[model samples]
Target chain A: MSAPHSATSANGVPTLDVARLREDFPILGQQINGRPLVYLDNAATSQKPVAVIDAIARYYREDNSNVHRGVHALSERATAAYEAARETVRGFLNAASSKEIIFTRGTTEAINLVAQAWGRSTLQPGDEVLITHMEHHSNIVPWQMVCEQTGATLRVAPINERGEVIMDEFERLLGERTKLVAVGHVSNALGTINPVARMIELAHAHEALALVDGAQATPHMVVDVQALGADFYALSGHKMFGPTGIGVLYGREALLDAMPPWQGGGDMIKAVSFEGTLYSDLPYKFEAGTPHIAGGVGLGAAVDYLAGVGREAIAAYEAELLAYTEARLQEVDGLRLIGTAENKAAVASFVLEGVHAHDLGTIVDHHGVAIRAGHHCAMPVMEFFGVAATSRASLAFYNTREEIDALVTALQDAQRIFG
Target chain B: MDLRDLYQDIIVDHNRSPRNFRRIDNATRMAQGYNPLCGDKLVIYITLKDGAISDVSFQGEGCAISTASASLMTEVLKGKTEAEAEALFDNMHRLLTEDAHGVDVDELGKLAALEGVRAYPTRVKCATLCWHTLQAALEEVDEPVTTE
Candidate 1:
């Protein structure tokens, strides 16, 4: 469900007031290259709204203290804010308990946490880790490293030309020896929203655990990890209009309790001594040392802001915008879209016939159109498409169709010069 | 800065039809260059005769800046001795990265058209990657030259 429902909200009003919402993001009002900035690089990292910025600043200004350590008033406030952020993330993902959510550096670290802590402890020499062709390097390399260290084999399922996982191939790759199945909830480079719900069911049927890379998906739609039955779901807050360096890893509570701590430090231990130390419980067992307290506060505000705007409304508006983008891009001469899956987020990756992707990126950038050009940390996808690179224009809910028109004009100007 | 200053007409022409864009069957030396940032790769081939570079060619896929830089490089370094070519690469380096007043333009010739790329700090690597590859070809390095 890209749109999930009709274009109207439950009250029959238009789902998203993008113009009013745009005002909250001050960066969107700026001018670059002597023109209005049409930011289309949300897939890399989104612009923060005033609420998130104020929350972070206010935390540092007033509640600046290490959490879970001090007994004073500021420490209590900091601890309260940090813990509440965890609860916010828990509710955002619809997890059973806040203990299931672990505050990590970002999605990359979250995946690495599972790969090192869970994979190293559970995997055996003959076990296998199954992943797809469309996975970002963060998902692929962590699993690869874990497999090498644990002597577990890594298997990759193939994707179709449309940059989608072939369900049949994916199922065929699963087996009794498959210990884990890692897949991206949405392809960052291609924007193909995968059928992760069905895939999780398939993985469970084979008695294998599943991890969903929800870094790209959480910014666009509501993620119910409980409903999806996902054993692990990793996401980055920066991609979802939160601050950088804060992300969440949602894992089943039982699975987390069984795993050893990935790192050792002050906050993660209950009793440290010359002898063996007793580790903390559940989430804190994994989060070691002094965490980014202010970042957590900011992320909480980001979650609150998105909840205020409504994820369903954001999804619907972006879906319509994506449709408009795809249609307008097709009108460009000698331009070809790379990912054409039936369902996708608001991401469009394409290559101009005469110009290299980097050239297009540089050209459009001069017109104040910011898009991503390169492998997008998905070299495997680039290899599959047989292209050196592709320019990607990823949109958020605040993006307007008029801004999309500006992108088209810049791209056309590039064509004229290169042609 | 203006986009025209970055994508000048001369650089555009060279990119559209690169010169010496071929692989030498048997060459004195060969080295591969890669811009991992952009997934751009190029191979520089050289042949020497009478203590001077007799032929030079390159084959690769990159942006207009990289392709034009490599194409124009081969055209200028055709008959220069090894030392002369090295000096020219140094000059090209200064021209792309240093202040304009610091560049000695005596030997830059038509290659000066690429001076437009100096305005873009990020694309500076695209303009200089070919020279690094050429430097590697003249040396004993076995691995590909990378602009990290």
Candidate 2:
């Protein structure tokens, strides 16, 4: 059974302590366009807290050295810190060990790694890779590349107009020919939190591995990879309030052992003598270089910050904000909420009949509210919903109800201009 | 929502009662332009009368700025010769992209409805998609079309 809770912590309520969270993030107190900055673009790249920033700065200042080969004190310290970060990530995702976690540039690169490494080796001609229609382009394009290269087929599982995956149809799409089923744990464009655990189970039942793109889900909710039974999972550090150029790709140990190294380079080699070198073990086999040491440390700090704030707290607060936001947004004449999925994160995507999403974003920005506009890198989702684009206001723990009110007021003015 | 600064009264009026939002039967040269970024598409139908643009119409789906821009573009180039139409297209592009071009804003004609597009960096492409398609149709015409 699912956890019997209202997405709240054991305190029976979500305790965000917004004032405390705000203090951790220095960027929150700044002014932009003559108004207090209301950062609603968390899904894109969340603002970093002081701890994560300091972690990155400290690593470069004191622990700046190449890892794995260093015997000196500073290099040893840097290597320890890098590996410690990997351990933190392993713990965060509930993976068996740190060996299963491979660091990459971001979720895009993480997905691409699996596509090139495991996908190339396993997928046969006429094999099918199942993905949802609402997948972000990162999830979609990598699978497309793999299919193109391996002569495999890419099958799209359709979602209902409400943005929920048609479970019956999804189950029907899976078969013996299905080599892999890749799906997003949450829809970045629509904020639909998919039931990936069930989907993963279904894929495994069909004898196919499942890769969950947790770029959107990881930041907003608790992600237990083992609980979800995901064979592979990917997440970006930037979305988790960490530095850019850092992400995690967690694959089953057996799968990682079987898959070839994506890039053959210095560290990935077991014994390089120009004759044919054996590849390194899991995790390092995929890393292949002096990894983003500082970035990984920063990501560890970010994960710590989120844990401190509590994911359940953030999820509950954002859910309340989304509820209020939806009600307020619906009050505006001619305004329509695009995605009404039963399970959604705090994102509110809407279209104001005559006003374009791009125009709405510009007008709202004038009020110091920064929201995302356009396809949001999910072009197929936009095409599915029959909208050119939408103005998306994605929320985080620091976002307040008052900021949502400001968004509503700004959107109301948008109606007057477009009308 | 500073209507006077961005969405002028002219823009709202033109958006409400669009001048030319119909299809042209047997249009000599018809082509469609799409701004995939914003999902704006415009299908331009042009009919030349003795090497001059006699009838021009458009029908497609887009936001207010793009649709009104399309509607206004059809109205602006209806009576003008091919050369005048081409010059107007250039002026519109300059106006949208480099608003500081000193091309008198008065010359914007009905296309002035899209001046709000200048404030919006992203939608500038939506405003220009129709004008670009019109220019494409003009370029296709053989034998230098009559100038104003």
Candidate 3:
């Protein structure tokens, strides 16, 4: 799997050997609809590498046992592996300690935990929880639920036509009454890379904490919670080339200590009695009952695989791939590209002149070009764009330029059929 | 399995120039249908008089299959009694969902264009969205119908 590091692009950046990278993802080798699969739906959920898949299988085959309580050798090994995975996650996010990392089912559960545990305890009536217009349903619904329960207001910061958050509006929304600002590090629908570090600074200036939804960002770029000054960061393991049913919530140690546990069960209890029960410390306090032990181990292996490939190289390579895709898509007559933010990831949402997105998606799938076609779970953004739905082609590092060409060809075929 | 089968010439023609693609001003009953998955939405309007559908129309945005289905449905349902329209709805649903060989194509007329939807399982909802809305309007169901 060794590629020449000396094969640098003109700008001194190392180019990703995509062919070599694609070999790592076993699913990419298969066919769809009698043709080679051209998967461009990474923003929804990424394809996992063999390393993560093998790690999960290995855990189940060799050391399938309960963690923390049992004295058996298998239990000890499982416990060590699970806790070691936590440490890997801590390092992946560049968090200060593993105690701040709590495992949840995925990004949705992580955000809900904060909304219920922290928002319920801290937010007051007439207070505002700020979020952007382009937030996914996962980010918006949790805050809405929390606000409903606590009588707190949910304020939305406006985004410009390019799908980038308006700094002035965000600043205006951040005032003394704002208790928390929850925003996505990347817009899953538009591929807009938000300026979350600056947003966090603005939130802090107003005495409000910031939570970054890094579900879309973790797969494409480097995310350091400390560097971004994020009070809390949420990400899904499945979206980041790991297994489903596992995710990490990175909170500041002080905040984790102050917040009450969202769920209560065996693992979260330090000492239990009929009259009185004491909760465990940070991390475990939030992670109650049996955890997704194999998922955590798979996520750790995913982290190791990503590090081995190098995040910087992936980012750079994806930038070129995105530029190429956008250019090729522009050649298609009557194809309108959505979300042309100056700063973007490799996701492209578009609509053809006369064809409905669903129709286009169906036709494209026939050609084995798998793209997401719908509101992409960001209905508010769809409303802003004045489109009911858009066909999206989101790229990962493993995608080749040839696959993008195949997508373009499929779209052309769709146009002919609809024409 | 062919794209031509799914996007039949009749379906494309109807989609391009949908019949009765307008809201009824004196509509006695109207119901909205939405497919949240694809973001397709439509409203079915009907004027019932003497137990017969005196006037019928629809206004919405959806895929070609949906638009054409609604257009053809409006054309077929103009003089139909409430019970006749219900029977036709059941027939169309069966045509799209069940085996194509089992369907009586002679009864469907222009609606047979949508028979190709039987081959594409995911699109069965798109072709049936309008029929469902039509049923809701006839039944006077207050809640919006959704093809989940």
lDDT of 3 at A12: 89
Give the DockQ (C-alpha) for candidate 1.
Answer: 0.86
Query: Which segments of model 1 are wrong by more than 4 Å?
Result: A1-14
Model 3 residue B33 CA deviation in Å: 0.8
- Candidate 2 DockQ, CA atoms: 0.49
Error of 1 at A349 (Å): 0.4
Give a tens-digit lDDT track for model 2, residues A19-93: 667777899998877888888988888999998999999999999999988799998999999999999999999
* lDDT for each residue of candidate 2 in B68-92, tens digit (9 for 90 to 100): 7878888878778888888888788
Off by over 4 Å in 2: A1-11, B1-3, B99-101, B112-116, B141-148
A1-419: candidate 1 lDDT, tens digit per residue? 12322247576655877777888899999898888999999999999999999999999999999999989999999999999999999999999999999999999999999999999999999999999999999999999999999999999999999988999999999999999999999999999999999999999999999999999999999999999999999999999999999999999999999999999998999999998999999889999999999999999999989888888888878999999999999999999999999989989999999989989998888899999999999999999999989999999999999999999999999998888
- Window of ten residues with lowest summed lDDT in model 3 chain A: A1-10
Where is model 2 chain A poorest over a 10-residue stretch in terms of lDDT? A1-10
Clashing pairs in 1: none
DockQ of each: 0.86, 0.49, 0.86
Query: Cα miss at B121, model 1 (Å)?
Result: 0.3
TM-score for each candidate, following the candidate numbering: 0.98, 0.92, 0.98
Residues A1-419, model 3: lDDT tens digits: 36542247788897777787788899999898899999999998999998899999999999999999899999999999999999999999999999999999999999999999999998999999999999999999999999999999999999999999999999988899999999999999999999999999999999999999999999999999999999999999999999999999999999999999898898999999999899999889998999999999999999988888888888998999999999999999999999999999989999999899988999999999999999999999999999999999999999989999999999999888878
Per-residue lDDT of B145 in model 2? 19
Error of 1 at B79 (Å): 0.7
